[model samples]
Each structure stands twice: as C-alpha cells, then as structure tokens.
Target chain A: MKARFIVSPVLCIGCRTCELACAFAHAIDGKLGKSRIYPIDGGFKELWVPVTCLQCEEAACVKSCLVNALQRNPETGAVELNQEKCVKCMACVAACPFGCSLLDEQHELVVKCDLCGGDPACARFCPTKALEYKPIKGSPKKIAV
Target chain B: MIRITINGKVTQASEGETLLKVIRREGIDIPALCHHEAVEPYGACRLCMVEITKEEWNGWSKYVTSCLYPVEPGLIVKTHSTKVIEMRKTIVDLYLARHPNCAEIQQLADEYGVTKTSYQTVVDGDNCILCGICTRICDEMGFHAISMVGRGHGKVVAPPLDEAPANCTGCLACAQNCPTHFIEFEDKGNSRTIWGKKFEMITCEKCGKTTITKEFADYLAEHRELPREYFNICDECHRRSTALDMGRIASWSKEVK
Candidate 1:
C-alpha cells in the first residue's frame, strides 16, 4: 500500500520516543543515532510537537540536489537519498522548506526520512499515536510488508 | 572521439579518458578498490587489471591497471579475459590474506572463488588493504592529513610523525570513503576522535544538534570564504531561518500593498 508518515502535533507528548526509535533503527557501530525527527516547542505552555519530514509532493530538496541524488521512491512515496551520488554540498539542506533534510554528522551527507523503506520505526515505537505510517485512502490496500 | 574495442564491443570514448571510466560507462564490472571518481587514479589495488592489445603488435598483449590506463585509438581491451580473471583472483587472494577480518575483503574474495589464501594469512593484521584511497581522498579534499607510511608488509596509512594530525579537519572523508571500511573514527556526543586526534564538534544553536567540527568550520571560513556564522547553525536550523525570512518577505510585500 502507498503510505506516508504523519505526525499529530496535538497528540505528541514531546517524549522524544520517535527520535530514539529513528536513531536506534538507523544506528551504525554503536554511535548515537542522528535522528530524522525531533521535538520542537509548539508556542503554548507544555506543548511540544515532534517535527519531521512532511514528504512534500513537490519537494525542494529533490530539486536542489546537485547530483540528482535525492529521489522519490515510488512505492513508499518518500524522498530517498542515494548516498553514492550525494556530494554533501548542503544544497538540499538549503532547499528543504520545512527543514526535514538535515546533515548526518557521521556519514557527512544530507539525509531525510524514507518511511524506513516500508515500516517506519518512529510510528512503531511512538508512545502516542502521534506518528503513523498511514496508507493513502485511494491507493492500493492491505499489501503486507 | 576515440574508438576502443572493449570486451569484443567497440565503443567511442573521449580522448585520454581512463579506460576504467570508459569501460564502466559500457556497463562492465571491473572491481577497483582504490578508485574514486573524486580522486586521481593511484593504481594501488590493481584489481581493475585488464589485458590490452593492438593489431600491429602481432597479438602480444599486456595487462595494465585500467584505472591508470588511458583510452587510445585502435586499442583492443579485454576486461575479463581468463588471464585478467586470474590476476584479479591473485590480487584478491592477497587481500584476503591480509584482511581476513574485513567483511568487504572477504566478500570480494568470495566473488573470485578464493575462499582460502595461498599465502600465509596475517592473523594479527588489520583491514587497511593499503589501497591508498583514504590518503588520496584526503589529498583531494585538500587536507593531506593522512598518507601511506613505511613500505611493503609494514606499510600503513598514518598521519605524519605518528601523532594526531594537527591539520585534520575531522571531515571524515578519509574514513567514510574507505572501500574496506577500514579507517576508524568515533563520533559520540559533541566530540569526534580520528587519526589519534580529538575534535570538539559544533552544536546547532536552534536545534541543539551536533554538526561539523570546529576546525572544519574555521577551515571553510578561512579557505572557502564562508562567513564564520555559516557553520554556527545546523542545516535544518538554517533552512528554518530561510523559511522564516521568506515568510517575512511575503508579509512585508502584503503590507506594502
């Protein structure tokens, strides 16, 4: 099924569990994970919203890539960063509107979420249902991972 | 354009293009460990060895490392002939003897059906295959922080004087581009350790995320002429500020109406 990772600001407790989940899932060599999602203050008292890639339809990050490294995975509908072609010039870092594309300190490449290639760890480990990998309503239905 | 026959197929290539580049463009698989498009060919791995011949040489052929060999008119190349395969097998077998622990080397050996080494395995050896890619990439990145030290079996990639490289910006280009994944470094919290040197990494002011090392930032500021404040914020925070500025521009234009 075609899916997207969505976050509910109101339901987020700002526990940073999603951050931990993403970081843990992507960790290499026991290094601390470079989280693709993080909790940001949401203007009101005690209101923290976990922010992440919205996976925009016409992503600026994809456009700004010098080597055409960042691309859309058709099945997942997530922008995938091809590490081989990426030069780490940070053009995508400047192009992303919502700031989802960020630099990976260890790999020295700009990276963004890819819905974890199918099963998103952030949605799986989210304490609240704030983060979810929801199927598009009109897309293909109930194909198992 | 120059015409070169590769693997029984004639292809037109630009003058002086490396045979590996032209051969790769034709979808031929020639394993080159020390070869990186970002750096000049060092021919350290010799894995891309291919046999070449010409009609005027009376069928005599010479095996040359394709990464270093340039394409020439009327040159006939065999990328994976029996002799080329044998040479690659021998090279990979030597690599296996030296770097048995490295998964990359082991897998490469497996591809050539060289499960056991004919030479004595260096049990105490580490996975520096002496490919020189790391040192070359460092030089390409303008760091020159590491280089090939010593020679023969005792040769290794090390910083000068065996001390922490004072010029190392901790850019991780050397470690990240390592084909065998041999170069070692640690990035935990706001500090990074590599080449026996420790560097304090910069943290983003807005997002509190650790970014590049301070030395790398200062180097960019001095060499690339980037403002020192450019590295103060992480990419995400920088994008956020750009979005805010764009919003301000939109609102200001609206109010001016």
Candidate 2:
C-alpha cells in the first residue's frame, strides 16, 4: 500500500485556485462556475495547498475514531471513513497531527481527501502545475492533464 | 499493520501514519507546540522534536519535528533520549523567554520544568514569551495582516506600520485570536484605528543603556528604506557614522602620543 502526498512549495505561487477548485468539486452544485460562495467558516482556504491524503500507514483518524467509522482502504491504501457510522465524535479531528480532516458544515461527518476517487479535481484545476497527482514510488512524474 | 521500532520498542503502526502519530499513539508523549490536529503542521514551533535512527542513512540519526515527519519502513525513532530531551528543554526555554506569560507556553514550560527564561526580555514590560502564535495565526489561520519581522533576538510580530491595506476588511482576527493578548485595538483621538498595541524595544547595541522605540526602528527600516542589516543601529550610532574618516583622524593621534 502506498501512502504519501508530495508538494513543492517553491512551485506554488500562493494563488489558492486549488482551494477554489476543491471547494467547487466538493460543493453541492458540483461546479466551479461562480465567484460568490458563502464563506463557510473552517472550510478550506484559498492558499494553493495542492493537498492530498498522506494515506498514513499509522492513520491517526483511524486510531482516534471511537465509533471505528474510519478505516484504511485496502485497495487504494487510503484511509476511508464510513460516514454512516460516524458519530461526529471529533476524535479523529483531534488525533490527526496534520489537521487534514475537517468537519463538514452539516457537522455529521468528517471530510478528507479521497484522491477524488483516483482522478483528483484539484490537480485538474491547478493552472501553474503546482498540483500533481502521481504514484507513490520512483520520481513524482508529473500528471499530464 | 506495519511493525516498526520506536525508541527501541517494537511497535505496530498503520501504513500511512506520520512519525509523530506513531509515537503519540504508543504513549511516548513527545512534546509538540504549534501542533493542533485541526490545523496543518506549520513546523514553526519546532518543539515536537525527535531523533530518527535511520539505517538507510547508515545508522545516522537526525533531529526533526516529529509532527511533520512521516514514518518509513525500517526507520528507528528515538523520541526521548538524553540528547533529545536537552534539545527540547533548550527550545522550550527559548520559547518561554519569547512568550513568558502565554498559558500554553507556561504549560509547556511547566511540563519541561523550564522555570527560567534564556533570552533577555524586551523592556516594554512585555511578558512576550515569543510563541510565534500571533504571527502564525495571522498568516496561516487569517489571511496575512501581520508577520514576523527580523530574526532571532531581534524578531518581532507586527503589522505593516507604514501602510494599512485598503482591502483590510477590518476582520481584527489577528488581535482577537492572539494567544498572548499582546495585541490590542484602540481608538485614536480623532479616528478609530486598530493598532497592534505596544511592544518594547531592545537597547541599542552601541548606546548600552537608552531604549529606542520599536516603531522607530521599524520606521528607520521601512520609511527611510534602510537595509534590514542596519536596522538595529540606533540614531546615535548612525549619527557617528564616520569610522572611515576617523581612520584619517587616528593617523594624527600617533604624533601626540
């Protein structure tokens, strides 16, 4: 199972388009075609984070989950949380050292990167080649489109 | 389950966990400041220090912030060795001196038994303690109204004094969120302008006793457009700016001797 997300800060221009794209991809409307969106407190920021799940071998969210809702996906080697089973305990919120997982606005479940189901929308929307989805081994060969 | 040795104890960790999460789960209790599970690892606090014993790197151990460091296969971690503890103590002490009165700082100091501060306190009677929390909050949490200026002993946290942004949005998030309560918003006599309150300045390196204003130093650097390297020199030291000409004066002193 592979687990890691690499980001090059030097390549990042701090544009925050990745954040906009992530919010759009996760938005209820499922489109990036608007300028004004309600400023959901504690959502994602506009900084170009190019963030992806580390898919930690020792996942904090998995260990911290009291309800055992969060688990590591065997197929993709990613930590996957069962939202139906999630009780919103926020233990995973406190357990994650990177502070990656966040409670959605509904406050019913924690939200995290699922690699956009193998085709990331954030990587797709990045303009300056700052965000790249790559394999976990060898050199991080840039994703072309 | 990935089996690994942490501080020589054989432990099992999940596949993608960071080194910090691994040791923390084992109840090793490594010290970490500026680390919140809800926020990304800023790595600014440098308190969650650990020595990694990596065989791939020829049994060489390097100091790293465990919070940001990822766990690797065959990696040996020493979370609490004598050297690591000492380093943590020194770092905690430095942080304490920078922010002497912060609650989180005091807590960490108490945990480390850091009763004394290592750096000299600024004379504005500030308990500053230097957690970098204010700057971090402004830059990382809020969108960047304030930032850290200077480096090491001369470092300070403040907003751009010479100019205020038209796009300020008047959030006041930086002051509202400061852990130290060092930042304050006040109404000037005529207008209500939120300022970063007051902070003490260090004594001039040359004058030996007189204290200059922190804003004055900032003014000299920013308004006068002086290079950052010369920012620490006081106006008096700068006024006597004739060391090159003084060499010609010194040549005549030998005749009187």
Question: Each candidate's TM vs. the true structure?
Answer: 0.68, 0.41
Query: What does candidate 2's lDDT look like per residue over B1-257, in tens digits?
Result: 87778878888878777888888788888766555443356677687888887677886789988878877777788888888889989987877776666677778889888888878854444554455655554443334666676787667775676356332323344454444556666533322345433334435466643323344334334533444444344333432332223333433443455
lDDT (Cα, tens digit) per residue for candidate 1, span A1-145: 3676776655667799889998988876887558988776654545456667767777767755434677888888888988655556454564455667887778566678878899999999988897888877764543322
In terms of lDDT, the best-performing candidate is 1
Q: What ranges in model 2 sit over 4 Å off?
A: A1-145, B1-3, B8-17, B25-28, B37-40, B55-59, B101-103, B118-142, B162-165, B170-181, B185-257
Residue pairs of candidate 1 with colliding backbone atoms: none
**Model 1 lDDT, residue B209, Cα:** 84
Candidate closest to the true structure, highest TM-score: 1
Q: What would the DockQ be for model 1? A: 0.08
Question: What is the Å distance of residue B242 in model 1 from its true position?
Answer: 1.2
TM-score of candidate 2 to 2 decimals = 0.41
Model 2, position B251, has a per-residue lDDT of: 35
The 10-residue segment with the lowest total lDDT in model 1 chain A? A136-145
